[model samples]
Each structure stands twice: as structure tokens, then as C-alpha cells.
Target chain A: MSLLAEIAVSVLIVIGASFALVGSWGLLRLPHLMARLHAPTKATTLGVGSVLLASMVYFFAIGKGVSMHELLIVLFLFLTAPISASFLARAYLRAHVAPDVLPPAGEQGWATFARRSDDAHDAPATSATRAPPQD
Target chain B: MSDAGLLDHALAFGFVAFGLALLLNLLRLVKGPTTTDRVLAVDTMVIDVIALIVLLGIRQSTQAYFEAALLFAMFGFVATVSFCRFMLRGRLVE
Candidate 1:
């Protein structure tokens, strides 16, 4: 490999590794589940993406031709990370927070853990009164 | 210094850094207060592990590990989705 290519690979690897390190640090030190969620999903995704880019560039420079497989992992991570985060957020809301405590959802109703309008209609009107709002 | 020597040094540094990140992620996984936090830790670990595998592939100049990394990403996504689904629905299957 050429010296220039080696330097580029080194820079990419270091940046990627640093991002990963900061991301895990956030995970360890963040105060709450909601706050901690932001750290890993965004930073770790970028961290891994950068590292994969380094690998692709390194292989290309080494006369191994072009390797496109790493792109698959990048695509998968981007697509799934937000979805899993969303699911977890909804789960946390459903288990811990009462519907009335949530910020009003306007005309559409609660964004997550929305009881079906029909179920809302059939249940005792006092159901909302029984469960105290958390936070 | 030779190009190979530089590359070797960089790879060594990368391996150590990524290994440390992985260990810290495990720490969060064990100590996280909520199930959601643990799930997020595992999610981050999966990404870090993928990065480590790609770094290893670069160091070794091998293409075989690419497929392993891709497979691992797929598995991690599936696991996260299912775990979230269970948490959301209170059951794995409908």
C-alpha cells in the first residue's frame, strides 16, 4: 500500500475508534434510560459506519479490488437502530407512564400505546383517574 | 517507516481501542437500571463488534470476514427487533 493510503486508513480508524469510545462512555454515564438511548444509537452507528468505510478503503488500496459487502452492514444498522429505539421508547411509556400524564397528542390521540378508541369508549370513564400520571 | 509498518501500528491501536469500547459496553449492559438500557447496550455492542471484525479483516487482508460481519449485523438486528417486540407486546408471537 502507498504511504498516503496508509495515512488515510490510520486517520479513519482512529476517528472511528474514538467515536465508539465516546459512545460507550455516554452509555455508562448518562443519567436516565431516555437520555442514554440517544448516545449509542447515533454515535455507535456513525462509529461503526466509519470503521467499515476504513475497511473498504483499505481493501481497495491493497489491490483486493472493491469490496461492497460492508455497505450491507451499514445499511442494516441505519435501518434498524431507529426502529428498535422507537419500539423501546413505546414499551417504556406503556409500562411506566399513564396516558393522561403524557403531553396531549392533539387530534390524532396518543402517538404510542394508544388504546383503541373503541376500548376507550367501553372502559370505565374513571380508568384514567385511577392510574396516577408518572412524571 | 514502511507502509506495512504504519498499517500494523494503526491496526494494533484500533484493536485495543475497540476492545476497550466493548468492555465498557458490557459494563453498561450489566449495570443498566432498566431493561431498555440493557437492550441499548447490546445494540451498541453489536455495532462495535462489527467494527472490530472489519478492522480484523483489514489487518489480515482477508475477504472472508466481511460475510461474517454482515451475518452478525443481521442477527443483531433481528434480536433487537424481537426483544423490542416482546417488550412492546408482552409476548414474542402474536
Candidate 2:
């Protein structure tokens, strides 16, 4: 290999490494599940894409011919990451329903248990209240 | 130093930095608070692994590394999808 080619390959590696570093940084720095999802989906995708492109270049330059394998990997990644992130975020939302949104505990138990118990005990009384006038 | 020498140095430094990044991602995978966070971290880690495989393919000048990258991509997608479905429905099977 010529000197220029070697230098180019080295430069490509460095660029790829920098992208990986930034992606990792974003993963660590982002706060909250929803916010952290953004980091890997966006930064990491591009970062890995660049590195794979560099690899494609290095291989082709070395007379390996054009490689489409990395391209396929990139396509699969682009297709899947977003769908997974959205599913997870939705799951998180469902699981984290606000406590304030729930009815008070006593009211809930009364409505759930006491109402049924009262209906069972006061069947005739309830019927009398409902009967218009069975004279 | 000659150009070959410079290139060798660059490759070494790049690999080192890439390794560091992989480690950082692994840390997130280990310590992530929620299932979603861990899944995200794992996704990022797998992407980094694919990149690393490509780098290895270049560094070693072997076509076999491409196969690994391809497999990682395929299986990683399946894994992510399954995990997401599990999180959403709380079951892997409907």
C-alpha cells in the first residue's frame, strides 16, 4: 500500500472513533428514559454508520471490491431502533401513571367493595326505594 | 516517521479510543435504572460492536469480519424488537 493510502485509512479510523466516543458520551449524559432514548437512536446511529462507511472504504481500497454488507447493516439499524424506542417509551408511560390521577384509596375501596356489600345487604330496602307504588 | 508509521500510530490510537467508548457504553448497560434504559444502552453497545467489527475487518484485512457485522446487525434487530414487544405487552408471546 502507498503512503497516502495508509494515511487515509488511518484518518478514517480516527473519524470513526470520534463518532463512537460522542455517541457513548451522549448515552451517559442524557437524563431520563425518554431523553436517553434520543441519544443512542440519533448520535449512535450516525456514529456507527460513519465507522461502517470507513470500513467499507478501507476494504474496497484494498482490492476487496465494493462491499454492500455494511450498507445492509445500516438499513436494518435505521429500521429497528426507532420502533423499539417508541415502544419502550410508551411502555414507560403506561407504567408510570401519576398517583394524583388515581382516586383516593378509601373512596376506591368503598366504591369497589362497600357498594357491592351494601347492595347485597339492602336488596329489599333498595327495591322499596325503587318501587313506584306497589299498592 | 514515514507515512506507514504515521498510519500505524493513528490506527492504534483510534482503536484505543473506540475501546474506551465501548467501555463507557457497557457501563451504561450495567447501571441503567430502568428496562428501557438498559435496552437503549444495549442497542448502542451492539451498534458499537458492529463498528468495532468493521474496524477489525479493516485492520486485519479479513472479509470474515464483515460476516460478523452482518450477523450482529440481523440478530441485534431481532433482539431489540423482541425486547420492545416484551416491554410493551409484558410478555414475549401474545
Candidate 3:
């Protein structure tokens, strides 16, 4: 590889690795679950995206032929991270928070708790109510 | 210096950093107050491993790890979604 390409690859790798470390650190240290959810999903996604870009460029510079397949991983991560985060959030909500405490959202109520939250007895209070989920 | 001088140093740094990140993720997995936290930690660990695999591909200049990384990403996402789904609905399919 040429000098410029080598430097670029190194820089990208370093940046990607640093971001991954910081994101994981945030995941471990953040005080609240909601705050914790945002850290790795965003930072590490970008972290790996950088590494993938670096991989494409490094291989191209080494005369291995152009390969654009890494973009598929980037695109997949972008599409699914949020969906998973939403699922985790809904899981947290369904398992922990009482629905009545939530702000009103029409007759149907919020989709997460709408089916079971109305009964009140089912969820009770917080995760302590994990027993007898009923279904 | 050498032909692979700066690049080798960077790869070493990258490996150590990612390895440490994985350790931190494991710590979170162990100590997380709730199940949601553990699932999130594992998801992050999978992503970090994918990135590590990409770095390996770059280091070896091989194309094989490319498919591996992609498959890891795909499997990680599906696993995370299913775990969350099971948690939310109390059933994997509903």
C-alpha cells in the first residue's frame, strides 16, 4: 500500500477502535437503562462502520480489487439498531413501568401496555411483579 | 521504518482496544441491574466482535472474514430482536 493509503487505514482503525471502547465504557457506566441503551447502539455502529470503510479502502489499495460488500453490514446495522432499541425499551416499559402512570394516548392506549396494563393486577409494580405474567 | 510499520502498530492498538471493550461489555453483562441491561450489553458485544473481525480482515488482507463479519451482524440482530420479543410478549412468536 502507498503511504497515504496506509496512514488512512491506520487512522480509521484507531478511530473505530476508540469509539468502540468509549461506547462500551458508556454501556457499563451509564446510570440509567434508557441512557445506557443509546450509547452502544449509536457509537459502536459508527465505530464498526468506520472499520468497514477502512477495510474496503485498505483492500482496494492493496490491489485486491474493489469490494463494496461492507456497505451491506453498515446498512443492516442502521436499519436494525433502532428497532432493537425500541424493543428493549418496550420490554423495559412492559416489565417495569405502570401504564396508568404513562401519559394518556387515546382510547386504545399505548401499544406496549395496552393489552395487559389496563388490568392493573397483572403488572402490579415494577419487575417484582414478574411472577404470574399469565401469558 | 518497516514496510508494515505504522499499520502494525495501529492493528495492535485496535486489537487491544477492542479486547478491552469486550471485557467492559462482559462486566456490564455480569453486573447489569436488569435483564434489559444484560441483553443490551450482549448486543453491543456482538457488534464489537463484528468490528474486531473487520479489523482482522484488514490485518490479514483476506476476504474470507468479510462474509464472517456480515453473517455475525445478521445473526446478532436477529438474536437481539428475538430475545427482546420473548421478553416483551413472554413468547418468541405471538
Candidate 4:
């Protein structure tokens, strides 16, 4: 291993480590689920890429030929992380709303009554509470 | 290995940093208030693991670890896709 090669390796490693650190920091600092999703999705993907590139350089510089298989992993990661994040967000929204579709403010009944009264002028009082004007 | 000493040290440093990243991600996994948070944490962890495997390959001077890293990446993708599909459709089978 020549001095130049050693220096190059060290540089690569430092770059990779810095990326990982940034990704972690983003994880801790970001607010909310939707916002937090961006941190790992972008930072971590680049972090992993940097580290993998460092490894490839380290091995190949030493006469190990090309080890580009890590590229496949990078490809897969980039493809899936976003999809999962979106799906999870959608699911969270659905679950959060399922229980509160109707609030207990008595507003629903009032709206129904108003509509019934408008439709059945002949029997406003009876139609208001009985059903909904059968319309 | 003198010429490569600095490189080795740098790689080692990367390993340590990556370990810390893993810990931070784990914290997110533990403290996430929503399912999306947990899923994001898991996704980040998978990425970190893949990076770790590649670093290990460099450290050990072997190409074998690449295979494991590759597998992890593939599985992570599949798992993420399936989880997302489940979230969207409310059922993995459907």
C-alpha cells in the first residue's frame, strides 16, 4: 500500500462517516412523521452510498478487481424507501381519521334538520327529527 | 500496510460513526409517535446495515460480505414495498 493510496482510503472513510452522522442527526432533529421521513430517506441513502463507494475503492485499489455488486443494494434502497414512507403516511392518516369521522358537536344533527326542513315544507317539524325528509 | 494505514483508520472511523447512526435510528424506532415514524426508522436502519456490511467487507479484505449486503438491500426493498402496500390497501394479501 503506497502513501497516496492510504491517504485516499482515509479520505473516503471520512466522507462516508460524515454522511452517516448527518443522517443520524436528521433522524433526531426532524419534527413530525411526514417531515422526519425526508431525513432518513435522503440522508441515509447517500450515507450508504458513500460508505459503499469507500469500500469498493478500498478493495479495488488493492488489486481486488471491481466489486460493484453494492450498486444493486443502492438501487433497491432508492426504489423502495420512498414508496414505504408514502404508504405509511397514508395508513397513519386513515387510522387517525377512522375514529373521528364525526365529532360530538351536535352539528351533524342540526345540519340534517336544516336540510329536512328545507325539503318538506309541508311537515318541517315531523320530518326534521323523524328521518331526513326521505330525500 | 503502512501506506494503507490511514485508509484503514478512516474506514475504522466510518464504522464507529455508522454504529452511532444505528443507535440514533434505534432511538427513533423506540420513540416514534406514529407508524410512519417507525417505518422510517426501520428503513434507515436497513440502509445503515447495508453500509456496515460494505465497510466490513473493506475491513476484512474480502468480497463475500458484498453478497450479504446485497441480500440485505434486496430484502429491505421487498419489506418496505410490502409494508407500504399494506398501509395503502390495509391488507398485504389484497
Candidate 5:
């Protein structure tokens, strides 16, 4: 490999590794579950995405031609990261979050908790409705 | 220093740093305040493991590990989705 290509690969690897560390740090430091969700879903995607990019570049530099398949991992992660984040957010809202801390459920009554509100008097929304306003 | 030696040193540094990140993720998984937090930590850990495996493949100059990374990604996504589904519905499939 040329010196320039080698340097590029090294730089990519270091950047990717640093981002991974930062993501994990955020996970530990963030105080709330909702806030913590942001750290892993976003930072880790960039972290591993770049590492795989480095791997792709390194292979190409060594003249075995690019490993086109590595791109699939990057693509897959990007597509699924949002799905996981949304699922986790919904799960939190339904299972643990107080609705008053949320903006008004607006017209539809927050799709995730709709069924529960109809049957249970102490359903999530009812409790939120009774609680004093949170600043 | 020779280019190969320098590259080797950099790769080693990356390995250690990522390993530390993996450990931190484990700590979060254990100490998380809620089930949602633990699930989030585990999801992040799987992604870190995937990154580490790819780096290992790079250091060894072997494409063999690529398939392993791909499989891990698939399984991790499935696990995350199933866990979320269970948390949402209280059943894996219903």
C-alpha cells in the first residue's frame, strides 16, 4: 500500500474508535433513559459505520479490490437504528413515562396508550390528567 | 518507524479503546435504572462488537469475518425488535 493510503486507513480507524468511545461515554453519563437513547442510536451508528468504512478502505488499499459487501452492513445499520429508537421510545412512553410531562396527546390520544385509556380508570393518561402540572 | 509497524501500533490502540467502550457498555447494561436503559445498552454493545470484529478482519487481512459481522447485525436487530415488541405488548407475538 502507498504511504498516503496507509495514513488514510490509520486515520479512519482512529476516528472510528474514538467515536465508539464517545458513544459509550454518553450512555453512562446521560441521566434519563430517553436522553440515553440518543447516545447509542446515533453515535454508535456513526461509530461502527465509519469503522466498517475503514475496513472497506483498508481492503481496497491492499489491492484485493473493494469489499463491496461491507457497505451492506452500513446500510443495514442506518435503516434499523431509527426503527429500534422508535420502538424503545414507544415502549418507554407506554410503560413508564407520565403523560403530563409530554405535550398534549392532541387529537388521537397517543396511539400507544389509546386502548389502555378506554378500559382502565388508572390508565396512564388518567393519572397524568390528575397530577399537577410539571414545569 | 516502518509503515507496517506504525499501522500495527495504531490497530492495537484501536483494539484497546474499543474494548474499553465494550466494558463501559457492559457497566451500563448492569447498572441501568430501567429495563429500557438496559435494552438500549445491549443494543449499543452489539454494534460495538460488530465494529471490533471488522477491525480484527482488517488487521488479519481476511474477508472471512465479514460474514460473521453480517450475521451478528441480523441477529442483533431481530433481538432488539423482539424485546421492544414484548415490552410494548407483554407478549412476543400476539
Candidate 6:
């Protein structure tokens, strides 16, 4: 492989790997579920994208022709990350979040809490551990 | 079969970093304050494993791992969606 291609592959891999590590660190250490949700979903996707891009470059530089399939992973991930994240956020809100801390969503209140008021009666699911709000 | 010296060293660094990422995910999975935290950790683990597989393919100088990596990613999404669905509605579908 050419020196330029080699350097590009190495740099991309290092960047991708470090980002993945840091994102997971954030995921593990963040104070709350909503805060944790912001961690790995975006940064690590970019990390994986860079790694895949490096693979494509390495292969093409060695004269194996451009490989397009890796892009499919990138496209699919970007499309689905937000959707899955929203689903997770909804799950977190419904299972543990108290209604008063959230802004009023009119008569319906927040969709997560179906009780429609800031009353203390809504206890959410007993089976799930409560997510403590950041103080 | 990687012949480039710098590339080889970089790949080793990547292997260590991603492996450590998996360990961190495992820590969160075990020490979750809520079920959603565990689910999120699992999702991140899947992404980390995908990166490892890609790096392995590059290191081995072969294309054999691509299909497995793609399928793993798809399964990760499906599993995450199902987890959320179950968590939100207490059921997978209407």
C-alpha cells in the first residue's frame, strides 16, 4: 500500500477506537438515564463509521476496487440511531420519570405519564428501579 | 497478514481500545440504576463489537467478516427496538 493510504488507515482507526472508548466511558459514568442516552449512540456510530471507512480505503488502496457495502452499515445506523434513541427515551420517561419535573403538555400532560396530572399517585412500574434525577 | 508496520501498530491500539469499551459497557450493564441503562449499555456493546470485527477483517486482509458484522448490527437494532417496545407498552406489538 502507498504511504498516504497507510497513514490514512492508521489515523482513522486510532480516532475511531478512541472515540468508541470515550463514548462507552460516558455511557457508564453519566449520572442519569436521559444523560446516559446521549453518550454512545451518536459518538460510537461515528466511530464505527470511521473504522468502516478506513477498511474501504485500505482495501481500495491495495487495488481490490472500491467496496460500497460498508456504506450500507453507515446509512442504516444513522437512520436507526435516532429512532432507537427516541424509543429508549420514551421507555425511560415512562418507567421512572416523575411528571412534575416535566413541562406541562396541556391536558394530556406528558405522553409518558398517562395520568395527565402532576399528582403523586403515579408511581410508574414497581419492577423497574427508579432513575434518580440529576440534582 | 497486514504487512504495513504503522498499520499493524494502529490496529493493535484499536483492538485494545474497543476491548476496553466492551468492558466499560459490561460494567454499566451490571451496575445499572435502571433497566434502560442496561439496555443502553448492551446497545453500545454491539456497536463496539462491530468495530472490532471490522478491524479484524482489515488486519487479516480479508473480506470474510463483513457479512457477520452487518448482520450483527441489524440484530442489535432489532433487539433494541424490541426492548424499548416491551418497556413502553408491556408488549412487542399491538
Q: Largest lDDT belongs to which candidate? A: 6
DockQ leaderboard ranking:
3, 6, 5, 1, 4, 2
- Candidate 6, residue A101: the lDDT equals 62
Off by over 4 Å in 5: A116-135, B1-3
- Supply candidate 5's per-residue lDDT for B17: 80
Q: Candidate 4 on B1-94: residue-level lDDT in tens?
A: 5643576678778889999999999998999887667777887888888888888777777888877887888787778777665544445552
Q: Report the Cα lDDT for residue A24, model 6.
A: 93
Q: Please give the ranking of all candidate structures by lDDT, highest first, separated by commas.
A: 6, 3, 5, 1, 4, 2
Q: What is the lDDT of residue A120 in candidate 1?
A: 25
Spell out the clash pairs found in candidate 3: none
Docking class of 5: medium
Sorted into a CAPRI-style docking class, model 1 comes out as medium
Residue pairs of candidate 6 with colliding backbone atoms: none
Task: Give lDDT tens digits, candidate 1, residues B6-76.
Answer: 77877888888889989999999999877877888898898899998999888778888988898889898
Better of 4 and 5 by DockQ: 5
Write the residue-wise lDDT of candidate 2 on A70-101 in tens digits. Answer: 78887877787787677667556544533334
- What TM-score applies to chain A of candidate 5? 0.82
Report clashes for each candidate as comma-separated counts. 0, 0, 0, 0, 0, 0
**Candidate 3: Cα lDDT at B15:** 95
TM-score of 4: 0.77
* Candidate 5: C-alpha RMSD after superposition: 3.8
- The local lDDT score (0 to 100) that residue B57 gets in candidate 4 is 78
RMSD of each: 4.5, 11.8, 5.2, 10.9, 3.8, 5.3
Higher-lDDT candidate of 3 and 5? 3
Worst 10 residues of 3 chain A by lDDT: A126-135
Q: Model 2 in CAPRI terms: which quality?
A: acceptable
Binned by DockQ into CAPRI classes (incorrect, acceptable, medium, high), candidate 6 is medium
Instruction: After the best TM-score superposition of candidate 6, give how far the Cα of residue A43 lies from its true spot, in angstroms.
Output: 1.5
The TM-scores of all predictions, comma-separated, are 0.88, 0.76, 0.89, 0.77, 0.89, 0.88
lDDT of 2: 0.69
